[model samples]
Target: MTTKSLSIPLDFPFPSPKAHPLLTLHSKIQFPCKFPLFSLPQRIQFLRNQCPPKCQNPNDNNNPVPYTSQQEAHFTETQEAISQFLQEFGISAAESNSIALNSPKYAKMLFDSVKDLEEWTSWKSGGDGNEFATLGFKEKVAYMAKEKGDNGKVAFLESLGLSLSSSMNVARYLHGESLPNLIHKVKYMKEILFSDSDDKRLVGKYARCMMMNLSIPIDEDLQQTLSLFEKVEARRGGLDMLGSSEVTFRCLVESFPRILLLPLDLHLKPMVEFLDSVGVPKEHMREIFLLFPPVIICDITGINRKVQALKKVWAFDKDFGKMLLKYPWILSTAIQKNYKEIVSFFHMEKVDKSSVDTAIRSWPHILGCSTSKLEVMVEQLAKLGIRNKKLGQVISKSPQLLLRKPQEFLQVVLFLEDLGFDRETVGQVASRCPEIFAASIEKTLKKKIEFLDRIGVSKDHLPRVIKKYPELLVSDVNRTILPRMKYLKDVGLSKKDIAFMVRRFSPLLGYSIEEVLRPKYEFLVNTMKKPVEDVVGYPRYFSYSLEKKIMPRFWVLKGRNIECSLKDMLAKNDEEFAADFMGF
Candidate 1:
């Protein structure tokens, strides 16, 4: 089919609702360009204002959509604007008011898109008596999505399993973005994300998130991003896709506003290849994009330089790849600069570059954190003997501490001190399990403490127990701690038995039930002929390596016909046991 070129008259009037009637020349302003050049907000505002003062074809039975004040700026104006436009379109006052009140935001979009279609159709058809007047709102937008002025978009929308009104709603979004970009974006999405799926609505959902991102320019802004989205083939050679699910794809698009606007070959494809080369699995691509949106827009060469810098100084083994996956922004130029600044700060503090490098790799998100924030956290740590080389060591072991606000880290320190941990002991806990500083004051740390206390761990014992195993605070009380407590109860240890054992050895509760506790308890009851009560007295019974220590010692005792308490059998050093128990 031959393409019909749009022929707008030289005197074509562009709508300008914001202009006052006395300064009416602006309303009649001619557009030498094809599509209108105004921004989305202006377009919506213009539509709001375009509601005629008196509709030429008004239906009088119902009141027009009410104009009411809202906390949102210009919300009343938006409602007033929409009421008149809907009335001008011959909608009843009741319907107009319902639409205007329900969600004036979408009403604005619908009005803007429908009006754009009306104006463009008049231009294309040379003032014909509104060929679009007989059509519904969705049909008008589907017509706007024409490929070469044909039935391209109308057919595509029909295939999406949406209602006629819903199709029109999607078309409103599609209409806002230029047709060509919409095509390329949908095509790109289909190739990358939904190639294997037959569900057409999946494509529609992703297109809505990606095609008309508020951050990207549509017709008014420069339109010269290379059309790399076109002719892009699907992944080959069983490539790991960034992700396959609709949720991940939607999140990735929402995370990065300009993702659909980017050209495929020049931006995304190369970045995908780079990530794959660096050992980032395709399944993790969504995470990389979501965490560092600029990664796709950034020059791949710069990213390569950052990766090379990391490998040259440190390394990009599986762990470094894992670091990049965790904090993909580490490849951002700004983050790289921040990384350098942090290294320099640490150097001036007499912390070696290697230590800082280790710290960054261990917690790469620190690269994205502001240097001022890091310094603030540093000062906080200084109060706890965590400065200079010791600071670097603490950071290397638990670099996520840098992400904590100084106030938050101090809150954890204060809480620990209130629990009777001395400042020195608190410092030790900070070094041992720094993430406790980052856990929620209410959700995680407090919840675990309360769970322990409710289960009969005494106030006097909390300090020693928590200080010995600060990680217990970080473990999930329901998933990790409670289940283990339940397992002990099931194995003939009472809740009190478990609580007393935990007071002596808090880390005892953290062990895997199936891996450590289950086998030891079973053997203690079934094979060792020791009562399950034996473990309640010496919960360190779980900590010993079954094959390496416990079994070897127990078999020696069994052979020697020795009978002893759990403490006497397990707590003695092997040399002491052999000397004392075996008579060596």
Candidate 2:
């Protein structure tokens, strides 16, 4: 559809109102009251002296009459001047404010307005609107995006599932980005404005922040850089991030605006590909980018050196990929300044060299921290009655323990005290499972306790249950614990039996029903012809690998006419089972 064009008309005429009776020039020129006619310039000056535009004449006495020849000449000259001014600018008298024509500012405004109109007319005559300029900002953007062959980006923005106002707001926002062709750049930036999926106000906020922060006429090479960033986001589920109800994506750009200016192929691509090669899963790339956007932008040699230090120098035997996924900010830490001292400190503290990566994976933020800060954290843990080798074990198990400030740690201690645990018990619990320190005691821990209490574990028994299975305090009641217990109940275990099972085998809550319970129980009920009581009595049956150990032994025992129970088949190690049960 053809859009209407906007333009200024060249032939727009000024309208003239009815002239003053005495000021009107008749066919025969005659002066009123037989006054002698002055020269034209003098006549104009006499008219100005009679009545200025904004004020009354000072020459007149308090009582004034209209028919004096001087007044008549003055009024006539003033009318001629008004008529000439309107004809000069071609402005209609009806449209023109009489007060406006008398001021110097109005003359300047007329000059500028006329100049702009002339230029616009000339351009229109030569180039006609071409349909582009006539389009609204949004349609213009879509046309430009399509012209650049960026249908994917157009589709990407359209798929945001936003309202019409929100979509137009985004279009307007991206147009204001000052991109040469906004289509390519808009894809990378979609997340920043729409981070809160349903909030339209952020669109305005994002524009303001960009106008304040980003230098403009954005550099040309930055487009390619931003394109690479968009490729990364696209790979990492940009829509899902944009769909987030929280400010996850907005926080990413705010934290790392420099990511858009880095060299993509030379620096960013290689670094990201290197991380991917080494085991950084695509899922975790967003986290890595948000946390350490410089991972790709920093000196490639430096990033490589830091990575090598972790892999070769520190000897991270645990899966480096999983470690990177866990501790993405570790990539931002300096290799030369921080890597050695931190590794050595952990090593000196009795954390095994290979397990250093595991420790780092658990609490990646420690790699960014100072050795002295870590040492202080250790000393604080020591004051809590967890010192020396015990403190090292805690750090190794839960590296995030080092990240907690001294006061936050004290709060956890105080919170645990309120929960009826003594200092010694807290120390013991922390030593065994340092991850408990990371759990939200008020929410996660409290909910777990409430769930346990609802399920028949008494207040007196709470400490014992938690001490035995501390992970239960942080486990999702709906996702893990309840689902597994519901499966047990569906199979005929009563609530009392299930509660007894939880007390007897609290670790069973950690195993998956799909992977562990169903297969083992199927074997016990269907294969062994055993009752549900067998599984209830021995919950350890769920922990064994079905193919590797459990099934192989069960079939061999059945072939040999041996009546081996689930515990007997799984309890023995290879050599012990061969010697004792298999007749080796």
Candidate 3:
């Protein structure tokens, strides 16, 4: 579609009516005219003297004043000015007062006749048919007829075929009517002045006049008033007017708070169109727009209908629609504030894991702000035995939840770890749960073995140590065996042998062998190397036989000079050799 640009001047002035002749005369005449019964010629002369230079038509003086055209033009201008003034205040004339008055036919005729006479005099006098019309003789007649009673007022209004409410006078007296009422009054006056006149030009004049007169007390009312202009444009089929209305709406909505709450639909198509034309922020409008629900469902059964309607209206923006699905609170301020209650009211189905995950993923920061809530949620997952890493990732990513109460978080993490969690998982959980590392585990079998290695216990000996010291498994090997191992080399066994024996026998003996061996190394060494002959108590027999066998070798060796051979080894093997070797 081709777009038409409307350039509404920022300072368009309302058209003002020409001054009334009677008012001019009254201003000039200091004292009331006592000569009320003047001749027709005298009255003419009197009017001519008071009239402005433009109204002195010498050629037309003899004829009755052709005041119709002049009065119509003057009234039109004055009405235009009034409408413009009202529009400036953000008031609309149309929606405010659309009803015509109720009265008898004769009364309507009399009223119309009186109105025609007023118009004629206004033109002849070259005066503006405006608030100053009260000075005209025709106006006096209309006022007299109006005061005749309710019947008279109804008749006058009916002649104009306009709706007139009795409450209007009361409303004026009260001064309590809202902006909408003032707009209606201006609109009614404009309609009367420009009824069915094919001059499309006057519409702008009237629109501008209405725009000028408009005023709203609150931002919200101002928005509604501006929106009404858009409606006027749509009805009048004027794109320029619509564009102007849209520009005004944009300015008002931007400046005012809660103005976007005005309903915009088929009834307000022009407003919606204007908003679109001006590129108003859609997201910002979502909450305000939804505030006016076309149909409210009071029961669950009506949900389908509500959803369908909402979908149709919001279908263009999926994100907005989705927001509504999850957060209907966006529809109203009251609802948004009490959103939790609303959620509970609907007995909303439990959010699925995927939904919860999406929410957490979407706003990870919220988890920290709502740690207790999140923890409860996570606990539910735990109860479900969902050991998925994604849960851990969620917790880890939301560091706030972990850091909120470090001690509590750590405790939870440790508890999870104790349930057989792997280190990587535990560490990640711990990062999110800071309380676990607060205290160190006391030394025990497992801790001791770990401590032994920590103190430089060789890896090869670790298993052996564990095996021999079954009882030491419960002892603090780090404090006991570690201190005693240094004493092994001082006792006769080599450090390497001591280390090997401790590793091998520690577990079997169920106590740290290093602890047991440090005090008994000498006795242990003696026991380990004892000969088979000594153990069997046959040392004397073996010694005699060995001497008989080696005596010849010794004699042979002495003569051959092969000294320190078989004879020397046999000499060492004897009891005297053992006694000397031991230094006994």
Candidate 4:
């Protein structure tokens, strides 16, 4: 229900009847004595008895003068009620009258005192219904919370000028999660909520729902936020898309709470439709919407261009579908513009098309980097006397080089060069596993090197270990390396067997036990009838794309009565694989 603002007059003997139970301090008059609650007729009789001769009824001398205006009538009736109510509270009629008006100086003070109590009573009783009379203040609050829910309670508390934390405390206390201490705080908040004229929105139930449901507070900031929202909503096709129902409107607010304050036509619509047009599919749209709501409302044309370039220009494999599911924010990056330039720059540097595509598919963001950022480092490598085809090989093998600052790569190269490594040997080490350059000296690389040293990989054999798999320097001792080593031990590989595997194919340590190694090992042993030790003889087989290449080819071969070993089955490219298995 909507409550209108109380427009009580200065001379009115009583506060306005429509006044909220929460209003306090009528400025014009005050009553010294406490006033009792009285019925309407008793109030009228008291008014007639207190009527001055000049203000008395002229035609019917028995009745108080009929008020010429409603304000005067209400004033008369309220004055009478105040007089009788004071008398009922054990205030002598004479003393009440004296306090009511005897001293002209105290008249306003008396009237104010009377008005304050009346306002308090009205709020507590809630007028005609007196719904709050049976409940204490906190109980009343709890009742409101129970009946109206958190949103409603929140609106009520906000109107009171209480902080949200205080309201939450009250809720927690009621739920036995907190102790009570916030009564005075609640009162202070109530005063702030009710007395502030700027917050008229707190008066009506509908307006309260609008603010509460969306967690908006009534304030000057709200006005600005909502003003922008309305402007956006009214844009060319915005209103048509947003529609008119409050339910749908609230749903939008719930889904993207911050969208209300964002620009609509320019920021929200274009990127949303771009994703839709590019086959992002309807089911995954919510994940995109909720995770990156601002995507629909971003300067995302660059990101869109990247997606377009991947499909049209770069001829990126149809793996984009899975990439979106894995990295929804990829479409929000401003990388495509730089990516195109970098790819072309790489082509000029003798990086082959197949190599560039392979590197990009493995690390899609490589194309997003600007070539200029890496030119100094590439030039420095050429200065190291590794140029042309060799330089292309270095970059293709470690496209992550583009991601690092030039100084980072320069330092790593210089650090490797100081370690008595020749230029060619340094390039081979970096190309095999560029992540070593980024691995921490004190934290990651030193710790892993110590572990390998204890495993009997002598300092002489260390270079061979690194040459076999540079990724070992970056692999976690506890999380990746130790766990995989533990799994191999659990599968009956001794320290010697493990060291031999690490020396031959250290890439095996990079595959996760849970995600890659264990599952593939179980599949080969149980389904393909391969022995576990034979599987361990070639741990590199675990690194193959199990779902994409291994399983599909295995199932096809099983159907065709083909008995190829695991290596022959998974080693071929898709075309060679199809030709071998299906005789295409």
Candidate 5:
């Protein structure tokens, strides 16, 4: 018990045997224990091993560690803050993971900052990196940063490793509510995504979403934006991006049909016409065409059909035909939609299957009535013995017959035959009958041939007529009329003889005395240089003013300029000077 203590060596290799047993036990427990020390792994193994045994006892209430109030408060506060932030930014917290999350300004900020963390964590967790896959850690971080009210800070994070998230947010801005801001933002993102090869998926997704969200009736600015995207895609071969996005592709496909239907923009006019001419495949056209308002479709088709029907009837009507042709599409549309209107156009009282048949049978004989009436005539012809083919031949042979009264001419022919006349005799009798010829024939003949020196009927056709109807005109005045007129005029017959000749021959020549005399007077005025106004006794001097001044001035102004020498320009030729001045 004496203080015979010894100092232990600092570097002692082993414990002293002389040490107290209790001390030895303590030492063994503290440092020199030989059994395997319980490591974290071993502790986990022990816990796992004891779990089954502990679980078997049942009734052991091992409630999950209850959350502390502080922790709970923290979580609650965080959630509340997030809710308020979303509301402040006009976004829905319920749409947290939706694309809509990127649309709002606040949502974009959050998405940019927190999306990265989410993306990284997602990637670490074995996400496939597909756009549809869960976001990674980086994405989550970006989203969180955005939510924490640090949009500018989130943008800085994007520079680090969250470029895709940033680009996606920008694209959302473009498509979502902040379209104006998004437009500018998209330009920057477009450069980043397109410049880098690794972020193509993100770029594609952004482009697709932007296209989908664009308004249908785009303005010039938006159109330019679209054009830019199109150019980029074309140059970069990234159209697959648009194609992959269902929303975007569907919008584009719908555009053609919309344009075809309404054509709001005049720019689409030529395109529509071209499509019509080339004709979209029936199957494809039908699919899109069906989307048009029914009334619009009816109107377009009706107009086209009316035009075609009018052309068919009026092709031989010359001036009338030309007028109808000018509005072919309109006429066709009327005919297609309203058969009654088309028939009425020709002055037909009613249009039915019979009317249509008659119209077709009449072929080239639609000149007399309005187009609608002509259609009825054709219908009637079809009902008669005339087949379409025979009718066509007849129409071609005697196109002039369309101008005649159908019943009157038919009666004349029949009457001549009943009077023991042959076909030639019937033709002659029909030609002589006033009602069998068009009322305008005299005026038309006078206008067509200005002067006629000889006034005798041709022996060629006349002999045939005389041989068939020798009893009709037994008087020699019908044969020697021209010579008799000359003799009468020479022997003091004066204007009376000339008038008599005109009246006698008017029916034969298909003209009136007045029509023939007017041209003769015009010819005399032209040859003598006496003003037509003076000779014809026009009291207003209107004719004199028109002929001597207005007409000459008009001719000078309207006529084409001769590429003559300067001599002509300086000469008395007022016409040349006027033409030169007008650049004619």
Candidate 6:
């Protein structure tokens, strides 16, 4: 039967003509001044207690709010008649009584609202009414209870400014936790959130910001979160976190609030214990978590398995911690599976397993990349005729080559190729100075080419100069190269002479003025008694060892009292020099 509105029958015989028994029950069962939120079952218990055993309305005979589940007649209509008939939108019975006594029109409007709730709870909204209608009376009641909860949670998050589209996103990770438990968690988080600061910032909107910018926790308790912070605060490396342990804990909560849900005993302690056992230092723990916050939640047993597998392969049982310190993401990724692929690919290419381990030890993030990604880098290098063991050596020298986009890696190769290097010589340059592959094409490499051109290495000489010393692509122009040039020009070498010397050696600009150029040039002038112009002719003089080759051979020439040019003296093989000078 479908009655269109909320109307008590003309023959509701028990209560006064204007009085609604549902509203009158508000005064009968007195709750405290403070009202608490209730679940569906809890609110229904209030209904069952207040609703009379029988209340009849004999207007003709149709129920004004018909239930799709006819069995609702047994529990809701006949059993607890007035309870299901009143306004139920957070209205305590007390609020209902106030409306009944003072406002007859408002009471009638409240009565009319029950029709919508009745249709909604009885499978008329989205479910199969025919199928729901066949369920047992108690089963139908349970279904309505769950519907209220689902709607309430959505309303709660939406009220916090989470869009309806994304309100469920944070809930997905919570794994079906109840709404009351979520409220309990949010309530405590609010206490900690404003206990120190942001209290004044969000004073007028305290409840609104309690979700911590809508990254709310759904499955944890306040004590659970506090215990996790306590464990982190008490760690030996605890001080390394933003000064004090308490502030560091707050920083983690601020940056990665999901850390609140990770259990200390299961994830935090086990991870720290495993790391300590594996020789990872206590001082590095906080830094590791901050660098890769996901590491705090990674499975300790799985991480230990990866460490054990790596130990078997690298045989660097204690040294493995160094790799972790370099790239903490190794624990967060598929380290074991990726390492196996790296080992197999290197083995197939005839590169040693030790070389693979060395590559990972230097750039452990490569162990996170798939073998297919590594193969793409290899194919790119192979285009420059770098293949087989040469390929492996290039990768070990610069694992970042494996990390670059194929286009980014190719641009660097094309930059070299455009400089007139044949593919094979380009491959040789890559092998010798693998760091060049990592240089930014526009910012680092182009700026370097411009510096070379400015220093009198013309278009014709640029390729020859870079191919001779690929470190030119990687060296800092102002910090390393320009200072060396400035020192050379300051030391009585003209721009022309500096240009000629660098054109000859190509690495002259890359040499350290303090270490190599100054010490060697001082010895050449003061002790060996050579003219400074002598180096322009044989600038490769710097290439020879100062003490072993230059000093020893010059002393020989001085002893024999024979005159020789810089090249004639230092360029000859030891055997040739001895035979000629000693008359052997």
lDDT of 4 by residue, 1-584 (tens): 11123323345333221332213422322221222344545543343333333333335546654444543444443343333433443555654343333221122222333434444557553343343344433233223223322322222222222223333333433332111122233333223222323423212222222223232123333343344345434544443322222212333333333443334345444655666676666545444443333454445766666677667655754667555644343453334445556667767877776666666655554533446655666676665655666666666666555566667667777765654576788767766666676555667766777788787665666766777677888776777788888888887778887887777677777887889988888888788777777665666778787788788888898898888776677768889988877878
**Predicted structure with the largest TM-score when compared to the true one:** 1
**Whole-model alpha-carbon lDDT for candidate 4:** 0.51
Ordered by TM-score, highest first, the candidates read 1, 6, 2, 4, 5, 3
Q: What's the lDDT of the predicted structure labeled candidate 6?
A: 0.58
Q: 375-467, model 2: which lDDT tens digit per residue?
A: 877777777688656766777788777767777777777877877788888888888777878777677677777888899887777777777
TM-score of model 1 vs. true structure: 0.60
Q: Write the per-residue lDDT of candidate 5 for residues 194-311, one digit (tens) a residue.
A: 3323433544454454354222243333453355356436533564443222222223322222222233233223323422443333222222221121222234454445435554
Off by over 4 Å in 5: 1-261, 266-268, 271-394, 397-426, 429-493, 503-584
List candidate 6 segments past 4 Å from native: 1-287, 290-294, 297-302, 317-319
Which 10 successive residues of model 6 have the least lDDT summed?
A: 207-216
Provide the lDDT at 229 for model 2: 39
Task: List candidate 3 stretches off by more than 4 Å.
Answer: 1-68, 80-134, 137-175, 178-584
Q: What is the lDDT of residue 82 in candidate 2?
A: 33
Model 3 Cα lDDT, one tens digit per residue, 68-167: 5454443333223323332333544431112111122222233333454455545654433333344443334334233333322232222232222322
Off by over 4 Å in 1: 1-182, 189-271, 280-302, 319-325, 350-355, 388-390
Model 6 alpha-carbon miss at residue 412, Å? 3.0
Winner on lDDT between 3 and 4 is 4
Best by lDDT: 1
Query: lDDT score of model 1?
Result: 0.59
Backbone clash tally for model 5?
62
- In terms of lDDT, model 2 sits at 0.54
Candidate 1, residue 382: the lDDT equals 78
Q: What C-alpha lDDT do the candidate models reach, one value each?
A: 0.59, 0.54, 0.35, 0.51, 0.34, 0.58
Question: Considering TM-score, which of the candidate structures 1 and 4 is the better prediction for this target?
Answer: 1
